[model samples]
Target: VKVFGEFEFWFALIKVVAIVAMIALGSSVIFFGFTNDWNPIGFSNLWQHGGFFPNGIGGMLLSLQMVLFAYVGIEMIGLSAGEAENPRKTIPMAIDSLAWRILIFYMGAILVILAIFPWNEVGQQGSPFVVMFERIGLREAAGIINFVVITAALSSCNAGIFSGGRLLYALSVNGYAPSPFAKLSKYGVPNRAVMATVAVCMTGVVLNYFVPDKAFQYVMAAVTFVGLMVWIAILLTQIQFRRSLTQSQVAELAYRTPWWPYSSWFALAFITLVVVLMGFHEDARIALVLGPCLLGVYLAMFYIVGLHRKTKLSREFK
Candidate 1:
């Protein structure tokens, strides 16, 4: 896991550098249009074929479902808080950095792509990253971009395994999972939990082999739903946590979420919007239904086995 972290970090740096380069190059092309002989690469792509809102607000709304997948690993920065030596200092710094990271890496990259190519024609030309670089006459840019993308995918997989293992380890320690899953190897890795997590993930590979085309859509939607569900839980948990604290206790805290109550409320509203939008897309609706079905099973098991007592004990110990 430690080595995985190092690899993920390096690959992420590669992506950031590549994206920063793209944005810089794309900006030059847009404003100066020197590549186009000072033609002033304009918003014709945005509004020419159809207006910016060509598909209407509903189209924008539905796009959120896909967009959520892009943010799959955003929560990773804070996931290690329980084991961190200085979470109060590091966690806030991590969260604070996300604003700019999202701005430059995600939003900025999309802006460059949409501006450089017609909105509808962007995907048709191939990866905007490679296309933009190719325009600058780098034939190797496509292979490099493809390599970076492969690394990014690997990084995501590494993070997913680490997250799943840690979660099950947490549950095991709390007595919700088998006690053996909580046991760590000499290096302090939860071997049992990691193996179990990897096993579940491998099931997806097996499904893909058998189902091919249908497998990806179903799994992606399920993953998106889980991501949304986790975010909602985190927001609600934070709100409750803040509510539980006295004003003096809250003030004594080293870190606090800005805008207090409103921030939490707004997050809840935004997540609610995503859920509603999920229903608007047929493929996503599978997740909307299946998420609750899975939740119902979990709830039923929790009550049937009385995991709440163990959970309370876990919290008290923490």
Candidate 2:
């Protein structure tokens, strides 16, 4: 576990460094004209094309699917609560920083992209970052962006594996899965869980080879639904978790979600809206169906494998 955890940590570090570098370089180009072809492009381009909401309210709403995926890993900080040196203090500090960090990273990057190019053409040829660099006549900028994107993909995959592995380990420990899966390897890694995750991700590589570009987009859309499910689960978990605690305990919480039930419900509604929007877009519709289907299958397996029995035991104990 330690080795695998360290591996994931380093992978995440690489991704953060690459993104920071891209942001710094991209911002500098906008601040100072990189070449004659690209004058010091300022904020004017944001409204020059079709205005800030060129795609209108609908487009902005649709863009949330993409934006939400970028924010998926934000909750990883919360998951680290159990291991934190002082979770009460650290968790609140981390959550406190989330809003600003997201606004600066996602919104700031999008703003830069829009400022540098028309919104319609932002992702047409490729990534907006690559396009921006190429426009500036930076010889190796495209390659650099490509490299960064590769690192981003790796980081995402690594995080997914780590998260899934831990989830599976928890399930196994709770008798929801085979006990053997809960056993750690010599290096303390949840080897079985990691192997399972790697197997699923390897299928992605195969799909990439056989189906290539279109497959990736379809997979991304489908996978996004999993994100929505996870968010809903978190909200539900928090609600249940809080319900089991005393009023005093709640009041003492260092990192309480603001607005209580209202904020939770609002977030839930937003997630539902994203799902509905996915149905409107032909490419994302498959995900809407597949996501539910996958959940159904998991529930069925839970019952069939006697996990339901264990759950009943837990409830009885509670």
Candidate 3:
């Protein structure tokens, strides 16, 4: 697992460097008048046709749910906290980097893409990355994008499985899951936990075989809300943790979530708004329905198996 983690770290670094390079190149093409054969493709399409908020506030509101899912793997940092040598410092750095990541990697790329191509034509032109490359006379644009997309997907999937397996192992150790899930492989990996996670992911693979066109959409519609719920729980837990600490202890801490309770409250309100927005959108309704039902099952099991009592007693004795 250590070796695997090292490999993932390198792979992820390469991924980020590549995307940043692309964004820089694209921004240069858009602003400088050097890339597109000295024809600066300034930001006209942004508001030329129908103004900036072309689709209006409704479209922006609808996209909020999509943005929540976009930040899915951010929580993987929490999973790695147990192994981090300087988690207090490193985690805050990581969290702060997310703002820049969203700004540079996502928004910067988006602005570059929209500057070069109209919003409506983006989908019809295939990937905007490939389009930007093609505009610069890159003959291998399609192949390059294909390779990058594959690597990106593999990296994201690897991170997800690795983090989730660790979480399952933790749950098992804490008596929330089957004891067998706590076992580790010779490589010091949570083999059973990883296998179980892979099995769950394989359900999507199976769905792809049967319903290729709609598999991703259906799965996303059902599970994205769960990701938001996880995010909200983490935020709430952070607030509670801050409350548990003395003001002196908090001031002594090197790293902390910014704005403390206000940040958590704002995030909770934003997430709740997204969930409510999900109710208004047709495709998003699936998540709203399934998300609550899933939570209900967890709550029911907590009561049925006396996990709350078990956990309370464990904490008391500890």
Candidate with top lDDT is 1
Cα lDDT over the full model 2: 0.76
Q: How close to the true structure is residue 186 of candidate 2, measured as C-alpha lDDT?
A: 80
lDDT of 2 at 270: 86
Clashes of each: 0, 2, 0
Per-candidate TM-scores read 0.92, 0.87, 0.92
Per-residue lDDT tens digits of candidate 3, residues 1-318? 676588688777766776887777777778886556778888888888788778899999988877777777678877777788888888888888888888988888888888887888886866777777787776475467767777777887788788888888877777777789888777778899999998888888998999898787667766678888887888888888889999899989878667767878998998888888988877788778878988999999978887777643223110
**132 Cα displacement, candidate 1 (Å):** 3.3
Candidate 1: give its CA RMSD in angstroms.
2.2
Candidate closer to the true structure by TM-score (higher is better), 1 or 2: 1
In model 3, which runs have C-alpha deviations exceeding 4 angstroms? 312-318
How do the residues 75-103 of candidate 2 rate in per-residue lDDT, one tens digit apiece?
A: 77766775678988888887888788767
* 1 against 3, candidate with superior lDDT: 1
lDDT of 1: 0.82
**Model 2 Cα displacement at 90 (Å)?**
2.3
lDDT of 3: 0.79
